[model samples]
Target: MELMTFESPVNAVLSGQEAPERSLKRRVPMTARTKQLSDKEMDALERQIPDLAQIATKTAYARALLVSDSVLRVDSGDLVRISLDGSKTVVAKAEPRRKVKVGEVITVRRIEDQTAGGRA
Candidate 1:
């Protein structure tokens, strides 16, 4: 019988292998991770989530502004465009909220950006 060059159980036995005892002895418990916070202890942090989100959005908008890319978000039932300098332009009346149906298709209309001379 011919033995395969790779992945043959018989060949695996012939190849050299590491001793499991030494490998287990080298592992040490990791201590750098932060301790888990209880739900009550985390309430204070959760309260600041909105502030963090706003800051993150501003940072992201600033970066997008560098590339001349517009940010689109729905606010107060309308589609709003956010510029890099933090100016908001109402684009249009946003689509009404609705329950997600099975196999629904969302169509995003892309138009030309006249000011930046780029494809929308």
Candidate 2:
């Protein structure tokens, strides 16, 4: 008895040989979820927070600034709070496992509603 092996068309091409004739799937380019901010908008945001101006020049950091809903300030013991619509919202609670310095910027998402008593 003899065993037969199969190789993908991609592997054949990588080995410097032509792939056997078969239907090929069309590839499409993926689009980014977040878009870069315009120069005017970037200037305005930089004016608000001069410190971010240096980071905003980079592609990744610039996109984050545009997409984030709110940025919070971290307090001692890893506490973070965000203010929206004239109300203060707690984004992160103090964690005994970690220590964060005061005045550090932190990004957080709501995993569960605090009003629900931490129930998912």
Candidate 3:
């Protein structure tokens, strides 16, 4: 016995169609209302999302510091531990990713590693 494969010229039956959020088997009245957005609905959404995200992140960080007295963040390629009393300490050095810089070496390339305890 031999296996056969058929070539599909059509990529998908519902290529550009949107799927329903609710169950297909759910019953609904014929008079059920549906909301449709304007053409610029996505554009409006994209504009406001970043601002909301920043606010949410700031709020969460503020709450975390208030409850735990300290928070950590990566600054200038170094892990910094910040305290509620306006104090900062370098917890660990996060070195920059090392990759071969392309092109001819015309000038002396300085090693840009920020992490401590590495060969010069």
Candidate 4:
């Protein structure tokens, strides 16, 4: 009696044996989802928004001036001279609108020089 052997694809690969050719096939399904907004819906959304141009710039609680001296000062209610880059701005100091101590940080509305405005 003679013994015969047959090799399976998976077993042949695992045992370092050559595998026979076999056709492979795969099945896939197509799927999709989409939404559309009606013209009425768009018009309703537009009506809910207020006109942006109606918005106004924020009012400042306190005013400030920056001078070339690298000094930031609050309006002291007295006229003060701010000198910047060879220019001067004289801003009438108003009573410190906000409690500000010496050496407090204050942003200036605009950059000016010593000649900007002053009694001098």
Candidate 5:
């Protein structure tokens, strides 16, 4: 004896057009719910994961005082050097998300890679 394969007689069945068996097992509709976290719980979760805070701080854009057209003072201790043209200053290699002004504050973020033993 040899095994043989059979095809559906109707094209609707072959093309999965709401067959009787499939229609019988209907899908259940899902309901959406919003969840809110308390400030203390959120703080506890942040403390549990120190890297989350580090990542947030690193990605967050901050206003830095432009010491000069080419230099920006992020804080009392940090200074960032940027490229300066006649009237334009470029901070990073990529296009900045926000516009910058000379002799004024600009939005910037510090990008750093945490590596082990100084090797990537």
Candidate 6:
């Protein structure tokens, strides 16, 4: 005996154009919804945040005062008075060998350095 192989016919039956023995199944439908919150509810949610009182408050040091445009041309041991921003005055103990002369542009620069003793 010999085996036989044949190709299926390409017509309405293979393409599903004709009615089949059973009907096809249908897919289920889906739906979604969103809700809005009231102002009171939103405020209650905001209240959950912690209050950082200490973090908000900070301490700062007093700034150095600046000298006027006119320089003080005085010899050693000459006491000079300079006006500061807050209607205050700074008495600069003059040194004999200062490079600045009177009527010269002067700027006061204050530098604070740390000592090995750990005192500022």
Winner on TM-score (3 vs 5) = 3
Residues 75-119 of candidate 4 have per-residue lDDT tens digits of 445554444343434455555457878999988664356432332
Tens-place lDDT per residue, model 5, 1-120, is: 333333332332434443343333333335545579899988988786888666544333121112122433233333334323433333334433465577887655545563222322
* Candidates' C-alpha lDDT: 0.61, 0.49, 0.59, 0.41, 0.41, 0.37
In Å, residue 6's CA in model 4 sits off its true spot by 63
- Which ranges of candidate 5 are over 4 A from the true structure? 1-31, 35-44, 48-50, 60-78, 82-120
lDDT assessment of candidate 6: 0.37
Query: Candidate 3 overall Cα lDDT vs. reference?
Result: 0.59
Better of 4 and 5 by TM-score: 5
TM-score, each model? 0.46, 0.24, 0.49, 0.19, 0.20, 0.15
Evaluated with TM-score, which candidate comes out highest? 3
Clashes of 6: 1
The 10-residue segment of model 3 with minimum total lDDT is 8-17
lDDT of 2 by residue, 1-120 (tens): 333334544434334334354334444335436778999998898788755545444433323323353334456655544332334456566766656689988787766555334422
Q: What C-alpha lDDT does candidate 5 achieve relative to the native structure?
A: 0.41
How far off is residue 105 in model 1, in Å? 1.9
TM-score of 1: 0.46
Worst 10 residues of 5 by lDDT: 60-69
TM-score of 2: 0.24
Question: Which is superior by TM-score, 1 or 2?
Answer: 1
